[model samples]
Target: MNQTIDTILNHRSIRKFKPEPLKQEHLALILDAARSSSTSSYLMAYTMIGVTDPEKKSALASISNQSYIKDNGHFVLFCGDYHRHMLKADEKEKETLAYNVQSTEYFMIATVDATIAAQNMTLAAESLGIGACYIGSIKRDLDLVNDLFQLPEHVVPLFGLALGYPDEQQEIKPKLPKEAVYFENTYKDDEAHMAALDQFDQTIETYYRTRSTNQREDSWTKQMIKTLHNRRNDRLTPFVKEKKFNNR
Candidate 1:
């Protein structure tokens, strides 16, 4: 397989990192990769806030309840930003669509752009033998995080990324097989889908038994049922709406 495919296939979420920082040039190149990602309609609606300061990182770590946010050599928060576009529209004295409300299309596009940038940075880090982890728990306490980061309107903190040299290696998490995920011209019925899902669940259960960290005696289906039964983050809708994304 090609080196790129090898890097992609061997991906793992690294939680432990060495204290040493990444080289300045390497960090720059990684950021360049992030900037090089494709954006929807050329609207680079994402902002990355790299935090190295002890105080700021500590605050973010508290918010995320993940100590790696403070301990990692670098922590970056990727934000979905439309405020910049609005400011640009003002500069041009052109009337632009008011996306202050929950514009689903705009939110989706911005989120996709941010995700692409994040994945690009992650792959670049992996290629350089650096380890990284995506921190989605930042969304759990959005208000505190927003205040800590001083986010303006139309800017949502989608996720945080922590990067450093590896301190530990982890087993790559198994994914659903192609039979379960990939489809032909038409979508399959419940019977076909459930059969594939059952097989995948068995595979995941075996993987969990063998994994080094947080090993659990459970299948994918059971985990999903447990995790999804309660929509714990009811605040998500209100929080996004408070950020002025409130739209139907």
Candidate 2:
């Protein structure tokens, strides 16, 4: 197998980091690589807030409920930002910033732009021999995080990244079967959806259960049911609507 293919296959999320900090040169290269990623219609509608301060990292950790955020060498909040264009328009011509936001299409474009950039940053960091973990819970309290960072309107936090040299290794978890996901022509669903998923859940449960001495893990279906029934995620849809995307 090719070296690049091997790297891709071996990819895993790394949360524990070495005590050493990243060098300035490596940091600059990662940022440049991320900014070089393709943007929609050249709008470049995204921005990143790099946090090296311990206080700020602690704040993020408290918000994310993930202790690793404070321990990592660096934390970065990637935002889907359209405020730059709005401000520019306001400067050049007197137009309300919401003039084009009535449609949700533009909001989606900015989100895509931000996500692509964040992925580029992750790949670039790993290429530089640094381990990176994505912190998706950064959006849990948009109001709190926004106020913490003093972010302006028209910009939303997509996710965050914690980067540094890895101090520990974690096994790369298995992905679902190709047939369970990949579709050709029109989308095809396995007729026995529950059965197919049950098989996978058993596979995962057995593997982890054998490896650990802790309490037995719940089945995949149980976990999914608990997640959907939980109140934690119910706030997200309402919050997004409040942000003005208005999916309805």
Best candidate according to TM-score: 1
Which residue pairs collide, candidate 1? 102-245, 102-246, 102-247
Question: Cα lDDT of model 1 overall?
Answer: 0.86
lDDT of 2 by residue, 1-248 (tens): 97566666777899899887788898899899889989889988789999877887888888889988888767889987767776646553524455465247877887889888988888888887888998988777777887788887667778899999998887776667666676688667667555667787887788567753343777677777898888475666666655555353
lDDT of 1 by residue, 96-195 (tens): 3454335888888889999999999999999999999999988888888888889998889999999999899788888887878888998876677889
After superposition, the stretches of candidate 1 with alpha carbons farther than 4 Å from their true spots are 91-96, 99-101
Judging by lDDT against the true structure, name the best candidate: 1
Q: What count of clashes does model 1 give?
A: 3
> Local error of candidate 1 at 128, Å?
0.4
Q: What is the TM-score of each candidate against the true structure?
A: 0.93, 0.87
Tell me the RMSD of model 1 versus the true structure: 2.0
